[model samples]
Target chain A: MKKMMYISAVTEALAEEMERDESVFVIGEDVDIDGGVWNETAGLLERFGAKRVVGTPISEGAFTGLAAGAALTGLRPVVEFMYGDFIHVAMDQVANQIAKARLMFGGQAKMPVVIRLCACGAGTREGAQHSQFLESWFAHLPGFVVVAPSNAADGKGLMKSAIRSDLPVVFVESRQIYYDIQDVPEGEYTVPIGKAEILRPGEQVTLLSFGYACEKARQAAEMVKDKVDVEVIDLRTLKPLDTETIFKSVEKTGRLIVAHDSPAMCSIGAEVVRRVVAERFDYLDAPPVVVASKDVPIPFNDELEDYTVLSVQDIVDEIMKISVGII
Target chain B: MKKSSVASPSAEYFYRWMLAIRHSEQKLKELYIDHKIKGALHLSIGQEAVPVGVCAALSDGDKVFSTHRSHGHYIAKTHDIEGIMAELLGRATGCSNGYGGSMHLYNYEKGFLGGNGIVGGGISLALGAAFSAFYQNNGQIGVTFFGDGAANQGILHETLNLASLLKVPFLAVCENNGVAATTPVEKSTSETDRTKLAKAYKISSLSADGSDVEAVYAAASKAVAHLRAGKGPFLLNLRTCRWEPHCGIIKDTRDQKMLDDWRTNHDPLNVIAGRYPELLSSELRAEIGREVDARIEAAVAEAMTAPAPELAEYKRNFGV
Candidate 1:
């Protein structure tokens, strides 16, 4: 096993995948010579050369659509959207073309494209544009497979799986956890796209989250361990969600709390809560809760951004509220 | 119109294809009026030469991405009228299995990528295909066909810049049909000369009389040659006229006199027939028209009887 940061793990995965498959190439703004704004694709240009590691002009829609086109013609293109918010610039290509290409073409085409989005959290004070977790937008789309890993190992494993999948995958990364280090397995290993990991097991209530919020959920679980037994689940894949794991944990705990850094209204957390309520109504001890950011643009100030986003205290408080009498 | 040294065989081939597309479109119009084919139908009635001419310059391995008014492009590229007919009829035998109607047609095996619903949507896609061909060192090229209206879309300029910078084997064929939907090109942009769009990007540009099949074919051949020689991308603007409305069975809102003048003087079929009377005589043209009509009828008959796509098949496409 080798210890690496979350960002390095992503870079390692891209390098390994490019080495393994000739068809796999990297394309985006400043991804080649600059190695990416976050260095998530560092050293790819030298290793893969200019043909495979392309540094595109700042035309997101064109390059994104170009990547989709390349994917259609038997090349696997990994598109990097410098920031998660920049997906809006390429939404038509992302939501309309890439996501709908396969099914709209009657499954005649295989869109094996991976769109890697970085800087997907609020605490760094990048303001509304740069610091938004928009995975729910992709999760709502039908054809896309959305995956957000919270740590190094899952980051490496999930990225490999995403690159090899026949369908288009959206890889959401958080700047908040880029430097967070963890032990990734040596050699080759892949985390399945639709599987969730049980980070911590307990019996009182279930705390499910993804991306950087998973780290917060763990902290919240640790804080409430003496008063309430909490089960923390890292939902690695947002769509084709690991509902089996969620349902099993909710069924065991008899209570649920879905958390994420994205907004509360019409969010992935809401979808998770809805599913648990609809399917596991009999298994519920109390109403399922969604601990998410407020439905507003992220502020530029550090304190204001923290207020807008979900905090560890918020998860702990929600857990205490739901486990009041049960614990 | 400049005279061309096009051969007799090529002239006949172009005439036959133009007639087939014209007849198929007219048949589709009749079917729509008779409540046989439902949904939006955008016909390239007078603009058949653009697709036929451009496709003539492309090999079977070359990719062609087209716009919503793409029946002509699909027919010209793949000659799979029955498959496209089935698709328009929403049948399981359709090219896209009834999922995509008139606007979305894809036949990958025949190198026809698709006809996009959005304006300028296929430009970048074609660029990618061209990029793939260049990256793999394959002797293939990518061609995208869009109307004048789509030329104003931001994606077109963006793709042009990218294609020029990347030096991919890409060809952008803009069929300037005078108007975009209902808005005239004069009203849409200050620079009505669409060729300047490519020229600004430092890419090679060419203009052709879209109504003249020989001229369009000649221009397309030049553009294809330039692309094949690793000369980056080339933009060919085919000045044509749209006989039908932008979409559906809507009445043509343009000036009737202008439309009549175009039909009389600039009709692609008449232009070809008039230019090549020795090859496409009145009697020969009549025979080709009859054959095309019969094929369209047979395709319509087959599509009308084909089974509708099953719900289970659609559910299977949903990966979740």
Candidate 2:
């Protein structure tokens, strides 16, 4: 195992996957000479050359659509949407054309395209246009595999798995953690889609989250170490959710707290809360407390932006609030 | 009578396919009036020559992404008359297993990507397919067929620019039928000439009389040859006419004199028959007519009996 930055892990994953499969290539604005706006795809242009690492015009709809069309014709194209918020510009290509092609065409075509985007909502002062996290929007759509890995290891492994997948996948990454370093396993490895990893095991409270919120939940778990024995489950895949892992943890803990960076309304946490209530109503000792950002647009001011987003204190308070009398 | 000098050996096949499209659409109209095939149907009655000409220029490996008015495109490419009939009628044996109706025809093996519902949506799709061919180093070209309304879409401009910039082997054929649903092109678009839009993107383009299959064939052959030689994307703006309403059964809502003029001068079958009546002899015309009618009739009967999609089939398609 070697310690690597989150951005390095992603670039390494793309490099390894492209080397492994000749059909896999990266297409986006500034991916060639600029080496990606975030530099996650840096040095790939020199390694793969112009044809493989293409620099497209800032036409999101056209390029995203080009990836989909290429995927249908036997190329695994990883489309880079500089910001997750920009995905709305190409939603028709994502939701209508790419998603519906296989099903509406009676399963004649397989869409093997991955849309990688930076979805961090706080810090960097990038303002509202670039900082919104919209994974819930994609999870609601059929024929898409939505994933957001919180750490470098999972980021590299999940991206590899997403590239290998035959269906369309939306792999959301964070700008906040691009330089954050973590120990990633050496050699080829793939974290399977639609599975959860239990970071910490305990019996009092089950804390579930994904993306950057997973890190916040881990930090909160440490803060409330003496108050509540918290079990943190990282939901790797949002669409084909590992309900089994969630249910099993909830069964043992008898209390739940869902956390994510997006707004509380109809977010991934809301879906998790709904599923637990629907499937395991009897196992719950208290209502599932969801710790999510306030429902509002991300403000430009750093202080206001921090106020609207989730924090470790928020997770800790929610965990203690749900696990009443455990202290 | 004026004669056609275009005498390729494939003229017989082109006439048969065009006649097949014409007869099948007529049958679908009768079925729609009888309340058999439900939903909106965009019949390409007067614009059969565009698809026939463009498809004749393509090989089996090439792909065509079509628009909502796509019956002619589907028929010309695969000649799968039965599958298309079943698809329109929403039968299990349909190319899309009864899921895709008239506006959503798809057949991957024959390389008919789809009849997309969105205007100008197929341009990016076809461009992507062309890019894929270039990536694989395979000598395959992609053709997209859209209407005049789709020409005004922003994605068309974007795709045109991108396709030209990348120099992908692609063809964008605009079957300019003059009207978009109910609105005329003059009222809707400021730039009436769509080929100018292509030229602005630095892509080479040409225009042809869409009703004249020989002329359309000549234009498409030239464009296909250019694209095949690694030149770049080419655009063909076909001036054609639509003989039916935008959707549903053919209604007499169009101008009587205009419709009559188009029927007289630009009717695809009449244009060929008038030019070289011997090319379609009385016996050959009757034979083609009987064959088309019998095939459509048999397909309709089988489709009526074909089973509907089940719950498991839906689950399988969703990959659940």
lDDT of 1 by residue, A1-327 (tens): 898988989889999999999999999998876778888878888888999989999999999988999999999999999898998998878988999888878889889999999888888877889888889889888898999999999999999999999999999998889998889986688999999999999998999999999999999999988888899999999988899999999999999999999988888889998898889999999999999998899999878887898999999899999997876
Alpha-carbon runs more than 4 Å astray in model 1 = B1-9
- A102-121, model 2: which lDDT tens digit per residue? 87777778899999977555
**Ten consecutive residues with minimal summed lDDT in candidate 2 chain A?**
A118-127
- For model 2 the TM-score comes to 0.97
The RMSD of every model to the true structure, in order and in angstroms, is 2.8, 3.4
Off by over 4 Å in 2: B1-9, B250-254, B317-320
Docking class of 1: medium
Give the winner by DockQ: 1
TM-score of chain A, cand. 2: 0.98
* Chain B structural similarity (TM-score) per candidate: 0.95, 0.94
Tens digits of per-residue lDDT, candidate 2, B217-306, equal: 989988888888889999999999988888885555667799889988899888887787887788887898888889888888888888
Q: Clash pairs of candidate 1?
A: none
